[model samples]
Target chain A: MPRLTARERREGYQREYAFQQRHGKPFFPHVVFHDTIVSLIVVALIMGLSVLWYVQFGAIPTDPMAERTGGLLGPAYEAKADPGVLGYHPQPDWYFFFLFELLRIFKTPQLLIVGTIIIPTIWMVLLIGWPFIDRNPDRRLSRRPIALAIGVMVPIVLLTLTFYGSKVPAEGGAASTEPGAAAFAAGACSTCHVLANAGTAGNVGPVLDEAKPDYATALALITNGQGAMPSFKATYTEDEISCLAGYVATWSAAVGTTPGPGAATAKDYPASCEKAGGLFAGTVSSASGP
Target chain B: MSTLLPPPKEIAMMPVDWVEERSGAISFGKFMLFRNVPKDISWLQTLGSALITVFILQATTGIILAMYYQPTPDTAWMTIQWITNEATLGWLVRGMHKWGSSVMVVLLFLHMGRTFLFGAYKYPREMTWITGAIIFILVMGMSFTGYLLVFDERAYWATIVGVNINGTAPILGPALSYVLMVGPEIGTNTLSRFYSLHMLVLPSAIGGLIFLHMLLVVRLGVTSPPWSRMEPTEGDV
Candidate 1:
């Protein structure tokens, strides 16, 4: 596209303005009515889908009391101890999934600022500064290949990242072999304690590898709790607690090497954990012992 | 010039008539509403108007939501829950506001695209485009900050990530992050700061900027299609 000279651009704007003065429509009813109709349609669509889809609001807000009577959002949202996919790993809304995926892709701590901040900030600046930089007078998209390419690539990259991010687990580890993994997932320990075997990367508490508590210590902590880690005794059965403590003790020691226990045995605990139970139920052999 | 008002039958008449006579409100309204927009400006140009419409809808619904939403860390989520589940027609309003934001963002981008494609921001209208850019950033800011007001785990984590992203800027990154987050972390203070920005600062800035944008639109007149070289002759309609 040939750049317009200053005089040519000025004259062009003047001629356009003069033409508009002679033939332009009024803003009152014509433009106003057109905009209103379109906006009304949009509003109607929003309300219609809201009623039809009926989005599920998760558990109530996490509060101080939530610790005692389960979490504020309830146990439903808690990380599944059983584990096929750890669904309770907190993710941003869908719009932010692209960034979330970006964070995942740039996994190194050094690159955190680049993925999370620098790149996005640069994009925003470029977007706001686009008109200033691009002075081409051509009005057609075909003539502006560079601009068009950037526009198309942006959304495509975002969507691709978002799609990948949505399904990808936050942490890495082999599938849980021990039934204690089920108990761990069921008890919501995965939310706070990072355990590789269980595929949990919670940072709120000490990493299980670093603080490899024995069966007795795990059991004590699970029953009584300490610091920010609330006691799960009220929420779990003693059998379930034993399973979780044993699972953590074993897996915490064997951080990376082998997935301990070839498979789990099916022993019905009183508490039914849909998430954790689903994970262990399939993997269980008939060998039942801690 | 002859006076347009007809002789009134009664001296004390409608209140509107009294105001119109004293303040020339009718004339001002005419001047404001009857402004010309280029006939050649296609449906693409209407995106700006559509964006404004959705923005108004967002502001209205947001005002209603603010009536019930408590901006505390503890009660914020519970209040949102109440508003969503129990409040009369609250779900509809909240949904509209949410959807309206998406629509508004889409329209803003489309509108900016149209202006750029037509080269409307070339010379005299640069300020208009600049103000528009600022407004776009403000709108996105409002949306991001508003997302956290939901106080859900998703919202909380989103805010944490968002604030941290602010901290990723170069020299002023940490300070900017601190100011926005109201300390070094995302907490109740950060929530309140976001709430104030969403409800007050950004909206007010947008409102004033939009006024400037519209004034420029009215003053400079909407640009005709880039290809429209046909001029108005003496007998042209």
Candidate 2:
């Protein structure tokens, strides 16, 4: 942008270049060694935190039977009303929530390409092609209005989506109060299977209301895991399980009719469950701690 | 007199000096390790070096983790649980690897921002920036593939969703999704494919491209800020 003769420009550049050459430090022991030290410190910090605090993993993969039983109950229940009564709420990691929220908002099958594929691909292309697109040699932020605006806007939008994605819906029906419902909730049987009496909306497993298995079939499946459902034989005793199977069978048989002795209390829980404390500790307050 | 017996110092250095005599390895090391950059370059410029460091951490810890990890629907979650909860200080190694990934991503974004902010991608440094951009994409691919190695419910469902998103890509979408899924559905084959990509393919590609990027950086030298006193003259160009 500045007018100058070839001779003056050459002379001016030579003087500046020599000045720069004399002022810089070597990369090896200077910058490289400093970087290495910083990296080591970071690693040390991570290791220290890991030792001091345990990284808790979520409960073992969802037990499909839970959905049929009424969905997750007791302390583990996330009380969020799923958009549909049968669809499992699929939550992606926090980092991917923006995209997940995007998919949720644009729910039409026809727009899947636009929401899931086209938009992300365009962003990736823009990121990769940025150096070429903004070729101005000026390094000042004020000189690059368009690039600066995009850099700020992208993160703002992503953060807003992530915040909204994390919020659970508060509209799911209230927790059931029946004895059979208590067992279903206590055992976390409502998370994967759909049961009308239990009021659980999960669809990871077969709908118990539709399948309408007999008491014998229900007992057998409860004792031995089927499909994605884990065997509860080890977690619950014969008396507790028998009661549960009968309760589930009664509800399944009366799916469209008045619900069977529809409510349960701590006294109704088997003595074996009494020893377990957390799920069947007699008192309703302690049975499902927040 | 010295022709009869060389000094003790010379004798002590004989092995290294002998190797250097034929190979010029010492000089090459000196050239690489002692390269100069402008003094005004601050900690902001260290992001690239930080990325390289975190990458080294990821590769090291990842290899260690892979030794005990099982890539299967039934075993992957259990094995990862074993590593974090039971294996001796496995938490430290796994935690470092996990945190290292976050650090690498952050450092990469910072490095790219710095390069752009300083206009380092202009002129002779264009190839350096291009190579860097390629490496950036490769690193992201590596991260995404590595995410599925845990094989927990989250991992399984995430892959399902991710693959479907890939499938929504117009004409090539279905084909790419099929290739990634290793079939119409995700199963053992899909895990193995992602494992191979995470453990072998992407790392090798990234390593090669980073080497090329470093080569270009060495050729043109790191660029300066717009306000820096020094500028390349016509003769220097």
Candidate 3:
């Protein structure tokens, strides 16, 4: 089919106007009725969801330490924000999962901008510029296969991204009772590095479990820092640094290995934990008991 | 009719007539309400109105939530707890706002899909689509800024991540992050900034864009479902 000229397009609209005026129904009773019904349904659904969320989650717990587990919808709220603590995972609301997943895909520092700013901006530009790009006047789905395919594909891709994004493991696994594990978490090592024994999954730096750095390497990095990882020399005493290094070396090597090989024995923990002599020592005393 | 007294109906309409005579609001209301729309317009077309309804709900509930919502870092979380557990219907209001945000986003995508499928954005309706797209972006902005107002663990960390992501833009990344965070950290300044954006700036922009969007819709008339057999005939009525 030939592309309609500008004049033809204007005439076409005029004809559509006349046809609508002749055959169409009044907006008051016709369109307004449908709109009102849908709006009512929307309101009801929102209210139902609110009730269900509240009923399932119940109330916020009085005990701050007690778990505030949620039912289907999710918790009424999570624990209060503590900027001092970095052990918790950062998960955005579900609607933002696609962008969150995008960040994960383009994880490298250089490519992060592509996922964070460039791609989304381009997508928005394309969205707003779509009408001009698809200038063909055809509106029928069968006739406009390209638009239909795009229309279907965009949502499918978004839903897929959202599904995968939601599936990404929550960072910093459950807190452990082990003193060395407690020290590793409290020292804020879990904020930048992942370690299995500590149940931490931070991605800001190396995965200690994967790197499995030895005691010497862990001590040097912890004391002096390297690259993006900040030095903890001023922050911790010499003994404390050694204790953290030993903890990392032990757990990182022990993961996936038998007890006899490279694993640091349970006996090694108490000795170094005692030397650290603070919260680390306190946990050691508690772990040993009277 | 003019002898001693006017009828009760006319008396009741006197105030309305005064306003209408001054503003032309009556004629405009009639024009908006009684306009013709394509007969085959599907139920899917109602999604736009449904979105507006949800927006109104959000505004109403957000106002109530804001009444008790303190924006300081020290008290924001406590205020949310107080609202949820202590205030009457607070959970309902907060939950609706929370869940309503998701619903609004879903409906937005659905509504955009409908418009795309119908080719309603073509030619004369291009401005409508453009304005709608801007409104879409602004709504997402509302979601981002509003998330942090909760001040829970997830909200705080997620916002830090979000602002960091914004900070990654090529030339302006660091500057943008600084502005958004108001400093090196997400402190008292950041919380208040987000509150202002979520409740005041973003909503005002969205409200204005929505008005323009609706005005265009009323002007251009609703598009018929693309599959309908109707075609424009070049003949006098």
**Every candidate's lDDT:** 0.66, 0.63, 0.79
lDDT score, candidate 2, position B59: 85
Ranked candidates, highest TM-score first: 3, 1, 2
Q: Candidate 3: which stretches are off by over 4 Å?
A: A64-68, A170-290, B7-9, B231-237
- Top-lDDT structure, candidate number: 3
Clashes of 1: 3
Model 1, range A1-290, lDDT digits (tens) per residue?
69788999889778777767677778877777777777777677666655543344444445522211232222212221111222344555555667766666554445666676777778778767777787776655777788677667766786698787665344555456555565465335665567777777654456777666776777787786542233455556666566566566656746464533311222332122223354443244324432
**Which has the higher lDDT value, candidate number 1 or candidate number 2?**
1
In angstroms, the error of model 1 at B166 is 2.2
lDDT of 2 by residue, B1-237 (tens): 878998999899999898999999998889878877766666667677667777777889989999998887566666776676579977678767766776676677778877876777755567788888888878878777877786654465556667767777778977987899897655678888999999899998998888888888776666666666554444442
Error of 1 at B83 (Å): 1.7
lDDT of 3: 0.79
- Give the alpha carbon lDDT tens digit for every residue of B1-237 in model 3: 577779889999999999999999999999888888887885989999999999999999999999899999888888888888889989899999999999999999999988998899987899999999999999999999998988887887788678777876778877888898898667899998989999999999999999999999888888877776565444524
- lDDT score at residue B56, model 2, on the 0-100 scale: 79
Residue B229 error, candidate 2, Å: 2.6
Quote model 3's TM-score: 0.83
Error of 2 at A230 (Å): 22
